[model samples]
Target: MMFLVITVISTFVLSNESSRIPFLNGDNFSDWKDKILLTLGCMYLDLALYVDEPPEPTVKSSIAEKSSYDKWKRSNRLSLMLIKSHISQSIRGSIPPSDKIKNYMRTIEEQFVSSNKALASTLMNKLSGMKHNNSKSVREHIIEMRDIAARLKSLGIEIF
Candidate 1:
């Protein structure tokens, strides 16, 4: 058998002069060579018995397969309508009815009440005696946009 041939060859290689150079004592040379040959033979036997096959690749659905655009479009439209309704109600003297937004605003107001009050007072003073104006300053518009985005995010809404 292949095992018998490998064992004989390993024994012969270990018995060679170069292999015996590591063991200066002749008394333990045979024992050391036997241990080395046994270890090498075991390693060869293990390698010969090993089963080698490539691992199978995991399959995953493509984006289009996983996401149906039609369903998403319908849901997105409903969400936009809900946001618009909330904004319209807020603009028409109706404080947003959503408890989530109210709670979020309460937390923000508690944290930044002094700063917010000062900012609001300054804005009111600026607009107090002004004629009808058609233009918005870039800074004011940017703040408004940021506030809108923050409100949306606080409501657990995914913008993207």
Candidate 2:
């Protein structure tokens, strides 16, 4: 009885942790990707992200090889599902589907990397054109400027 309760609670906690990954809308890919990677790592499901797929087990495979293969397979399957589940439906249609987690992630990165260049340009223009305008508190205005700078930095652009 105690074991069953612990199992249920652990499952819920894990699910909740994954749920914290933000839905990948078209504009928020960078933030969404960061959260997804972090969440997968926390769940110990990021093995597929770092390791290439192992060859299928053969009849004479050693126990350790089989164990490693099984672990990689499970991680790939669950990580793929967790990633796809968090993508918004509108964006999902454009991504080429794949059973291999690495391929799927590559497709996602390809789709975003190009747009990030354009996004950086836009942010640069906005940051340069921004002015105090006297409508908001000076603190709020400075914070907003800092946020734009931070976003630009995340895209590999540094003003200094």
Candidate 3:
């Protein structure tokens, strides 16, 4: 009877001691939960950033290659632009215009304006340097011009 009592007491003491250790405390559990939540939140934000489809590859050198690349780029660009345009049109079509939609359209327009300016500058630079005799450089310049033209076309702006 004495031995049983001693054993029970010792077991209780050991358990209590172990539970008091910092590693086994309630604070550790809360810390772990916080870390897990932070990691998941970061992953969610990263996914949001890439929800849009990737831009199509644009570097190519042959007629077939150029055609395929241009087709893919144009398709992707059109898809993105259509998505934006549809959102704006839907807002304007509604009986009550949504401020949220109006703001979204404004943001999209601002982004497009800046992008167009950048593309125009790049095209002008490429055009200015057309005298290069290197086939590879000329091919790259043509591809750049094609991309700039496609981007402009997406914004309903024609580049002659």
Candidate 4:
């Protein structure tokens, strides 16, 4: 019972908000991806994004090779944890738990990083038709329109 309590406490303490970079969430993946890369790059662990997905035990692997694999696996796990920490709770289930950081990131990119033409067109129409209402300042309205253009541009549909 004592060990169980300790384990639970330690897990909570170690996995809490203090360890995360910031909230990236579901709506701002482009900026969030860049932020995540920058954060991990500063730590010199950004290469974990390209590392092999899972570490496998070699039947006749040399000590050096095995050690190298283990090191990469640890970094990969760190990358995965960081990604998981920043993922918005609303879209958390999109990325399943996996050992390979490359595949995990790939899956996330495919699922949430798309630049659909339909979405871009909708944004363009909305931008052109946007009006400033009494509740919002002109600054707020312009920022919202600029954000839509930015999103459209990010999707390769520039309308500047």
Best-performing candidate as measured by TM-score: 2
TM-score (C-alpha, index-matched) for candidate 1: 0.18
lDDT of candidate 2 over 39-144, digit per residue (tens): 8887788999999999899999999999999989998999899999999998999999898888899999999998898899899999999999889999999999
* Alpha-carbon shift of residue 33 in model 2 (angstroms): 1.7
TM-score of each: 0.18, 0.87, 0.27, 0.68
* lDDT comparison, 1 vs 3, better candidate: 3
Model 4 pairs whose backbones collide: 53-100
- Return model 3's CA RMSD, one decimal: 26.9
The candidate, 1 or 3, that scores higher on TM-score is: 3
Q: After superposition, which runs of candidate 1 have C-alpha atoms over 4 Å from their true positions?
A: 1-67, 89-160
What overall lDDT, based on C-alpha atoms, would model 3 receive against the true structure? 0.44
Evaluation by TM-score, superior candidate among 2 and 4: 2
Per-residue lDDT of candidate 1, residues 28-88 (tens digit): 2234334433533443322211222223233464555434433333333432332233232
Q: What does candidate 4 score on TM?
A: 0.68
For all candidates in order, the CA lDDT equals 0.39, 0.89, 0.44, 0.71
Model 3 stretches with alpha carbons more than 4 Å out: 1-99, 137-160
Q: List the residue pairs that clash in candidate 2.
A: none
Tens digits of per-residue lDDT for model 4, 1-160: 9999976865564455335556756556676777777766655456667655445668888887788777677678777878887787867775676777788778877776453545666788898888788788888888888888889887777766
